[model samples]
Target: MTPPDLSVYRLVFRLGDALIRSGASSATTTKALLAVCTRAGLKHPSVSVTLGQLMVSDQPDDGSPPRTRFHEIEPGALDIRWRTRAEEITEHYLLGDVGLEEALEEIEDQVNQKPSHQWWKLVVGYGVLGTGFGLILGGQPLTAIGGALTSMVISFIFRILGHLGAPGIFGYAAGGFVAVLAATALNTAFSLDQVAVCIVAAIAARLAGIASYGAVQDAITGWYISATGRMMEVATSTAGLVAGVAAGIGAVRLLWGPSVQLIETVEADTTHWTASILGAMFVAAGFTLASGGWAVRLLALTGLGGATELVYLFLLEVGTTPFLSITVSTAITGAACVLISRPINLSSNAIMMVSLMPLFPGMLIYQGLLGSLFGLEDSGATLLEALITAFCLSVGGVLGQYLFSEGLWLARRRQFHHTHPGESFSKVMPEEYNSRDIMLPVFSKPFNGSEARPAGRTPKGRPTADA
Candidate 1:
């Protein structure tokens, strides 16, 4: 194998380091490396990447070059080293020969480029999720449909905001709140069902949390470099959603007063095949819109989410305890996300945000707020339940990631053994290959063309080398 060019290797290394710091997954980092190598026109770039492995090749070997290989380490095993490398890359890439301003401008330009046609998928995803939310909240068909529509429109608006460089978290939160308010107002004005309105609003709010880059878990793990900037962009676009919903709700409350009843529970017959198909379509549409342009992928994701919800509903029908059902369902969804995300390039954040929307305790928050406003005693209980639900969701996500990472490590270990039966896998370097044994090659001129002088030495009292 030919030695890689040092300069090009360094460039790739730097970018990889940055990606690592930004909290990218091994798969994402590997893809980014491959992309950089491709952009640099490297030969056989695909073969050069081993997911989660950090290889430093200062100069290539004359014999068969050290092949890229995979080894699994505990998450955060090389965090410090990776962070330093990332910082170096960031410094050189953004602030070296090219001015920082120029580097930033270039980054912005890259971000603005439409890499895929996935916008329709996002619209559908958001819409479908909204419809499901309506069903869960016991909304009527029209209210559910209206809520889904409202959510889709808000999602499109946020996409535009994202293109304009809005922060993601704020954008999502704001979007969600606004969608809720809007749905609430429309339902109230037309004597529509509150259940349906709330469901749609919830779906719209959750869509704000979707991200194409697949960095959701990274954000939770303090992989801020990777997660922070992107999340901020999402937050900003979502703000509009929250604002719109809040406005609608505020307007409704002002006209109707706090005493108005939103939903009356009539014993309606359970929906069957037709209703299920319609519900599924709504979910698919919501996810499609939320996914931006990745409609096919979004459809698959919605199906998964819908299946999860259906299973939970089934368990409920069988008289399984609500708490147990929720716990089991949450675990299943979280684990499924961990297992399937990498193969398809979807981010766990998008999955978690959308899949969990049906269970986010929005009703609790609303009821709590209403109780507090009206000086009701049950407000405290509602607030506590809401907090606990959020906690459970967060905990479920973390547990899923940890389990997945460990599973990857085990799989890699098995592969390594199968490939090299006699070789012992050592986490530490062999004595001969340790950093201390590696010597810096000397570059010096010969003394009078007889013998080369060592670097940093001279015949005279004065030193030949600067330090």
Candidate 2:
């Protein structure tokens, strides 16, 4: 067999780096990289992915030496635009619509694509994001507005720190610290209730919801090394945020003494349904704009966020526990995104990551941290509850993906069997291939639930019985 040229390794490295930096999971990155290699005619290529780096290696079949390359992924915010373009190029390359050289150029173009929106627009989006979260967390109108201003300030701090090359954890810590100080000052001057609500909402973007979900999903998929790395990220990020908020609170207590009054905010009641829905949409839209995505894409995320919250609020009113309600809502949202993202030309991961922000435990984490700091007896329980909620969010997302992928596999198999009549299932899909393997190429195919080519179909459009 003729061996693939060295460009194959470069292709894998570039693609994997983009995906990882764009917040794709290690397993997903590895899968996409391998698919690229296979399509490029590289046999038995090995790809390894971690939180910060990727490694790819392959040997030539005609008695040539093996070549290995490694790439360090740069830290980047979640940008649906980048991921969407990458996926589109991959799909086109896989479908033979583009050659190797063209795909390589496309990858470089995406990596170098300038942000369409101005930096100030992103700051404005952050403000909107915080306001939405404040409303969702039951803050009053004034408090929600305070959250918006606080979040805008925090976004400024983050950008400045990034420009100065500070560590990411420190960025979170600084944002948290600023959030508390600003919220407290606003609350004191205006008598806005629910100070903590404002603070949490302002710093909601700092919460590790995506990392937590990725960690659990990686662990479930047996990528222990990547899972451990992601878990560590979640731990450090949350710890920094909690520590910053704690310090701000301590400083306030020391300065104001008895004059500083802090009160706990309760969850949103059913009467606040309008505010909650609006808040969710705000968060979704704000996230998209903040991430430098196209304004048109906000429609999908906003709709998804609003619908998910509507369902969640309804479930809560029906007497479901917060844990059960959030899990079910996240799962349903995940499945819905998977089903709809392809048709709309959006990234499912992007929608899932942003739409579920309202359900994240940012406020809970802050409340628990405050409780522990004040030496409240229920502090530990509150923190534990937050932990459980984060875990449930992860589980729900992973479960939703599996349910959708597997259900589609079954439906496709049944359709093929009905049409073929005499062919065995093993002819196309073997026992070794599971739903995950089929779904890993998500960037390459659409999940429209229609009659389409089987996942394992041959290049010539003929059904292949082999594994």
Candidate 3:
């Protein structure tokens, strides 16, 4: 095999690592790299992802031969800042002002850029994020406080364990266990009525790592290996979380009289609208900080999160099943998010990562686990229902994306943008803009460059179809 273009190889590897590390899907990474290579005047490239590795192969348009390079996918936290910046770089490159070298350097810088916000600030953001969810769930001040504090502690512990080189799942389980144990104590000690809601809300933020939307998107796009791997990781992490929450409850029950009711309760709006709205805003804000997202993005997500919850509530009141409610509401959010991606200057995927935070299956899953552990009569049925709810949320989110992709509005947007040139312009990248398409997309920019021809694998003058 001939040696590949080191520059193209480096850029592709860097971009893929950053995207995957930030929770972008394998398909998204492939799309971005293909787009980048195309714009950079390199030949068509093929990209593949496994659990902790990625391979990129470049071929001559002539089909003479192909050369490939492999890179490892490191475990890292979701930093929306890098995600946004990476998207911006892709957009910038597509714009064509920056050369291949400069664009590659800038992307590298984004990958290496240190977090601008302090760890304490992140802690506060997560606390506020949990508090907002608690409020939305009708948690009183005590429950809100408990949820906020517990979330902060758990997030910190998750980080510490990551630093200690623990498998990512260990941190998730630890956080879940710790959060529930603390929330349970608060509920018992203070007699808070919304303990279940509060605990679920607090843990919701971390559950984003499960990458449900990405998995579905990849599967639909024919990346089954990537999808299966993602699903397995998500399932393992979710099980760990559920186990932790259940373990906490079991331990707590041993110490005290049934800490939380764990019995079925009717869904009702016990909290005022003002409280719920505030909760939504804080949850969005907190999500932004914890994920290293920007202020502008936070504002959009706040409104989106609130609207989604209101839709969810309305659906519930209208007698929709919880699963259906989550699905329909997420679909709506997904469509709106795609339309707003340009204006918000955030990837739809990034927005969805947290916009639907309120719609996470954490609460439902917790309830189901509680039922089984406590030996409720309907435990089996409840568990099945919870699984179905998760299936709905993931499928609905992707359905919304597919609907948008095939819609006239998105078509017009794509047409206008592709035809228009340089308006100080940046765009969230495709489905990777993409339904990432966590489902977040990197930005795409256009520039032109010619690479020197190599042995049998000469550069194809024009971009070809992606692999």
TM-score winner: 2
Candidates in descending lDDT order? 2, 3, 1
RMSD in angstroms, candidate 1? 14.3
Backbone clashes, each candidate: 67, 1, 27
Q: After superposition, how far is residue 111 of candidate 3 from its true place, in Å?
A: 2.5
What would the per-residue lDDT of candidate 3 be over residues 126-162, giving only the tens digit for each residue?
8998898778777778888888988988878876987
Candidate 1 lDDT for residue 220: 51
lDDT tens digits, residue span 428-449, model 2: 2212222223233232221111
lDDT of 1: 0.47
RMSD each, Å: 14.3, 5.2, 6.4
Window of ten residues with lowest summed lDDT in model 2: 443-452
Which candidate, 1 or 3, would have the higher TM-score against the true structure?
A: 3
User: Tens-digit lDDT track for model 1 on 271-326?
Assistant: 45345434544454454444342445556666666666676666667887665666
